[model samples]
Target: MSEVQVVRGEMQPWTDRTSPRPALAALLTDVVPANRRTLILGPHAPQLIESVLAHSADVTILVRSVADAQQLGEDFGPCLQVIAGALDGLQTPPYDVVIASDGLDRVLGYDSADLSWSERLAAVAALAAPDAVVVLGLENEFSLLNLLDSRPAAERHGDDEWRPLHDDPSRPVSVEQLRTALPWTAEVYADFASRTYVRADVAANARPGEFPTRLAVAALEQTDVPLLSPAHEGVDTAARAGLLGSIPTGWLAVIGAQPSHDIYTETADTVLTADQNLTGWDTTISGEPVPATELSFDPGVVPATVSAGVSVESVLFRLASAEDVPGFRKLAADLGDWVTESRVVLRWDDVVYDGESFAHGVSGWVTEEPVEKEDLLAAAWVRFHERLVGQHRRHPWPPWMLGDDLVSAWLGMSGVEAPEQTPATSPDTPPATSEQVARGKEIARALDEVLGTATGTVDVRTALAEAEAAKHELFELKGHVYGLERTLGFRNKAMKTRENRIRELRGQLQKVTAAHERIRGSRTYAVSRVIFHAAQVRKPKVVARKISRKIDRKIRKR
Candidate 1:
């Protein structure tokens, strides 16, 4: 909106293949406060900092080193604040919005060379203003195996590589024990983002040089530690309201799933041109609901399905549990798709890495007699639960019965339409109550003081109290959430059973309708033609045949 421009250093995507930073900047315009101190984390080019400047006045860019900061400052003088030091302990100026542009992904795992990505991110979030917004972006570039390749060759097996353990500062990991390693790191950032900063905004910036006029951005970063993602008043509105969300002290996370790193520019343009009504408001330059290229009963296509030719066709997994009743249908795929400039809103729980396991299609599911189960997705889900619960040692949310995989699925489930623009929550949220109003006053006062406080970053009670008051409000929301859950739980069980019945009835009805239609349409088909020519035949006994033969002989002689 600020006279957007992209100085293509490279032969900018002749199409929609531009750097995502600009789109990211546009999305941040909605989340970042009008103007406050802002922090940019990691080794992004100065271009991202320019994006921050476009939205807010007071901005600071935090780099890995002071030298980089100085150099960056020279490039974009006076407007930049660079902190050159160890990321683990660097002091950051107070900021309202923090952008981590594909920077944290570098330190995601245990690397002896630097602090773990989680450590750096959590540390930065702690440095932010209590209610400040942090926008952490990770490129879909690295693979899960990159974390496992830390093992030294001599001590590894099965594509073994030297693996570093971030949590265990003194220990190293073996390759076979790789599955356990990836989540611990993924979990850490997942936890830190959940804790330090509530996702206030989630958006996809465009691929640099892509879409000269319009860009494709997918946003899933919205948190609730006094954070929020506002549904804009008009359609195609990026993030608009709910300035904050609560990140309880114990644990929380923000997760996203990128189907592919290689996005199609031609496809995006085609879809963009096709969606004239949506271009103005609700639109996605590039998002294919189904994984584009399917495989030939390939187990690798769906690691969760594991066996050759054994797969899952479909299961009732959802994102928002409270999907409007009418919006959901047993026969239709009506789930919501967030495709606007900044539409896809995601929580910390939606993140899944390559190692976690997913199937591109439900291949290998058909057998002589297919093994159909109520929760067909459960077998693979066991590993998912183990990862979230056993591997990461995180809380088993969404009721204990729903393992990590299902819970993760629900965590990522989306709606048929973008969530309606509303206040962070309704007046029904805790701040509405008398006690809550008092607590809110307390929290705001504390927040004001904490931002100005010189020391006491971790020990800051005002921030913690504000977190607590909001948590209490969340507690109230949790109650209603659970109440809706109880009602939905009953509905889900009923629906599962109902789906089975509907399937059987539909099968039977299809058979009956096909048989009846076939018979009605076939010209040769008739009740009297049971034997094909039965109507032309008359009963003929052996004795009658003999008498008729003799009479025919006498008649012939006469």
Candidate 2:
């Protein structure tokens, strides 16, 4: 078993937990010399160490963390020589191949001398032989990630960032500066988590239809954190401005000997390498070459053929941003025709179009499931609609036309009627299952969040406008309710007045009936009734005269 050598004071409890980078490991496989003395500086992934060991028999690793050193000793056994100390205390022979891709920040111990970034770089360079191949990484302080980072300044720095030395004057900021700082012929790459690397020169010269720009955009999009703005916009803007290479998250410099490929990227555990030709890329898994056409990243999801062409998403964005309805409609119709003919489904950003035909981009994603033409068209437009709205891209559609309505209009332009239920799901479009609809919504929401306008998340102005509208509606409702109450109160008072008049009339009729009954029941009233009947029979004229007089008296009283 290999033994740990403590050269000076060591950081006992620390261990670098940086994720392993398969793309970086694959790159190392090309540059590391066969059967030569190699020195790996700082904390690197086990996969990288294994890659270096595959090419070299004698390997030495220098780490400031004693825990990491001991773990390496146990993992590699006699194949590796582990040194635990600061970079200043290491005393070793010149190595034919030197790797410090983790950078110089974490290599300093608590008891070590305070060294600037340049001084530490010089110290690492001193350990390299005259003809050695050196692979070094330098983190960019002004990276696009740093610029878009939404975290506060204090939260961004952690325990490992105790001595970042980001303000050192002699430190290089760009790929060109890094190249000039190195002694040997250097090839630098814009490193994005070591999962993807783009040649600096290639990225700097990338156009809208090129592979480097697409790769840069894709790499920048592979983040799970909240950012101040979308990284893809920044990348695209920089690429268009011919300044993409100027804002790398980090730069990986290879000295003395360059790697065989211009770019290295790992997706779905498969490492893909591409040259400057940009025509195609080769994929490998577990050191064995995999047929590019058959490579699948997910179950039932096949990868599209890699080619060079104009990104459909970029074209759509341009048309929308310019508010060119005719141009956008034409493109949509053409795109719909292609999808109908090809029977393939891919994201707009993943699909590309040449002058003659549509093809998939170099790293395009595709699914194998057969989808209806209307569903496919609706899916495409839905995604486009989300991006256009979420990013606040100007379009010819009315401002009130948003979400599904906007998508439906866009679909209509392609001559496909949107489903009455929803753009994503409709009984007419039976091919789009419930699961598919849900997934599509999920993807749309995720895209919205990435664009910094999530579902139900409105801007301050929109929120205020909605609030004002609600307030106005409430006020109108309150006024209508008050009017109804007033009407009800008037009706109630009129009914009460009629009831009092009816009660008074009933009381008067009751009193009149009671007086007549009492007079009839009395002896005088009986006799008077008998006499009036006799008079009606014997003296009809006299009875008529008495009745007329009584009627006159009653009329006078009224």
| The candidate that achieves the highest TM-score relative to the unseen native structure | 2
The alpha-carbon deviation from the true structure for residue 92 of candidate 1, after best TM-score superposition, in angstroms, is: 4.3
- Residue lDDT tens for model 1, 1-558: 011111111111111111333333333444555577776655565545666687678766544333444556678766665554334544445666666644453222221235554455566567666666665543211211222223443433321211233244322122112213223221111111211211212111211111211112111112111112111111012212211111111111211211111111222112211111212112233223222121112222222221111111111122123443233232122221211121111111221212223223212111122322212222223323332333222232444445333433432332222223345465565321222123223322332232222121221233455588789989999999999999999999999999999999999999999998898777666653655565455764765788799999999999
Q: Candidate 2: deviation at residue 111, Å?
A: 1.1
Worst 10 residues of 1 by lDDT: 8-17
List runs of model 2 lying over 4 Å from the truth.
Answer: 278-305, 341-344, 364-368, 419-558
Candidate 1, superposed: residue stretches over 4 Å from native: 1-20, 103-114, 138-281, 284-558
Candidate 2 local distance difference test against the native: 0.74
Clashing residue pairs in all predictions, respectively, total 61, 0
Model 1, residue 217: C-alpha shift (Å): 15
Candidate 2's residue-wise lDDT over 490-531, tens digit each? 999999999999999999999999998888789998898888
What shift in Å separates residue 96 of candidate 1 from its native position after superposition?
Answer: 2.0
Question: For each candidate, what is the lDDT?
Answer: 0.34, 0.74
TM-scores of the candidates in the order shown:
0.28, 0.76
Report how far off residue 203 is in candidate 1 (Å): 13
